[model samples]
Target: MILLVVQTLNGFQLGMLLFLVAAGLTLVFGVMNFVNLAHGVQYMLGAYLGVTFAQMAGGFWAGLVLASLSAGLFGLALEWLIFRHLYGRSDLDQVLATFGVILTLNEGVRLIWGSAPLELAMPRLLSGSFALMEGLRYPVYRVAIAGLGLAVALLLAAGVHRTRAGMLIRAGASNRDMVSALGVDINRLFRLVFGIGAMLAGFAGVLAAPLISVEPGMGENVLILAFVVIVIGGIGSIRGAFAAAIIVGLVDTVGRGAITGLAHLMLTGPAAAKVGPALASMLIYLVMAAVLALRPAGLFPARA
Candidate 1:
């Protein structure tokens, strides 16, 4: 029971991280109509920069802040130099261009940091666990992450629903030409949106850095999962991304943990061990497939 509770929290943490990544991806996709495969590289950049900054600044918080800023700035530059050109191109062009960016960034990381994985030490304040119940304990850092994610979500919701810029973003999502006709500087708006998106992805990487190895191409797998979240939740909707991220996170976490246990009960230990990880990995994809089949438009499409 304690194990289950711990796993549940881990799942939630994972979901929160996914939300950060997917939210940005969905925003770029929904508003700009561009498919960016290189967004994941932003995440990789964050992790790398966080580590580098932390080493330079001599503190985790300073490193984190620096990493996020650097990532956002890099994103802005990419938007100006690369993504801006691909905006009006076909999906194939977008894919090809972004894929090249990914290749370039991945190689760049290797050149700067080498191929070795860098580790970010957790802040001292977040290094311990707290009792959640009489018997169950949870990591304080994971709880902090969940709280932070919730706060970010609320802020994002407010930004989207209350701000004039957000209003334009939504309008652009539905009809870019119409928004442009209103005399809005669509190019500038695109730059802001892309920067924000990049920052969010970077933030996710920073949050995840302590838990995972910061290495070249670390963002690739998570990027795939983020795409799946966007597809399941709906392409243009922040609300959809949030919902889908949590669902995928929980399903992936719990499914892997529980399936192995269940398999052990029904089959030999070796067989259970082999099957558990495989099945757990597939669970989220299975859910995605089912959702796609049922609601081709997605769970909560942006209000079109």
Candidate 2:
């Protein structure tokens, strides 16, 4: 029971980070009808900027603010310079171009930060642990991360469902041409969505910096998981992304532990060790496949 609780909490933490990244990616994909293979770059930028700014400012809070703003601005610049030009191109062109951006930026990051992994010091306020039960003491920082993510998710949900900007975003997602005909500056909306998406991804990166190593290419794996999230949740659906992220996170984390324990019961020790991890790694993909097989359009498709 204690182990289950701990693993579940860990899953939630991972899910929260995934949600932050996937939320933005889904918004951009839905609103712009564009595939951005380079979305991970913004995440990498966030972590790097968060660490640099924090070190320079000598304060974690200040660094987070500065890094988020910088990330948003950089995203805007990318949209204006590269993404805007590709809006009308084929998905193949968009994918190829953005993939180039990924390669360029990855190399740029290597040149700037070198190949060494960097670490962000945890905030002083959250650098301890608290007892969650008689036998379990959980890290305060992890709880804070989960709390922060939940807060952000709530705000995002409200913004999408209640605000006029959100309504415009929704309308644009449903039919960009129609929204444009109705006098909406679809291009401006695209920029706004893209910028917001980038900022959210950056925010995730900042939050994750302390927990994981900040290094070049760190965002690639997260990006793949985020893609799985958006796909499983239904492309362009924020709610779907949230649910899917949590599902993926839990399956990936808890499944590893659970599957391994079960494997030990059924197989030799060495075989179980090898097979357990391999099966656990495939859990999320299998879930995605199941969801797609049933829903085809995803659980919460934007149109639905």
Best by lDDT: 2
Q: Model 2, residue 179: what's the lDDT?
A: 93
lDDT by candidate, in order shown? 0.89, 0.92
Quick one: how many clashes does candidate 2 have? 0
- Models 1 onward score TM values of 0.94, 0.97
Pairs that clash in candidate 2: none
TM-score of 2: 0.97
Once superposed on the true structure, which residue ranges of model 2 sit more than 4 Å away at CA? 132-136
Please tell me which predicted candidate would have the highest TM-score against the true structure: 2
lDDT of 2 by residue, 205-301 (tens): 9989998999999889899999999999998988999999999999988988899888888999689889888888888999999999999988898
**Which regions in candidate 1 have their CA more than 4 angstroms from the true location?**
131-137, 265-274
The TM-score of predicted model 1 comes to 0.94
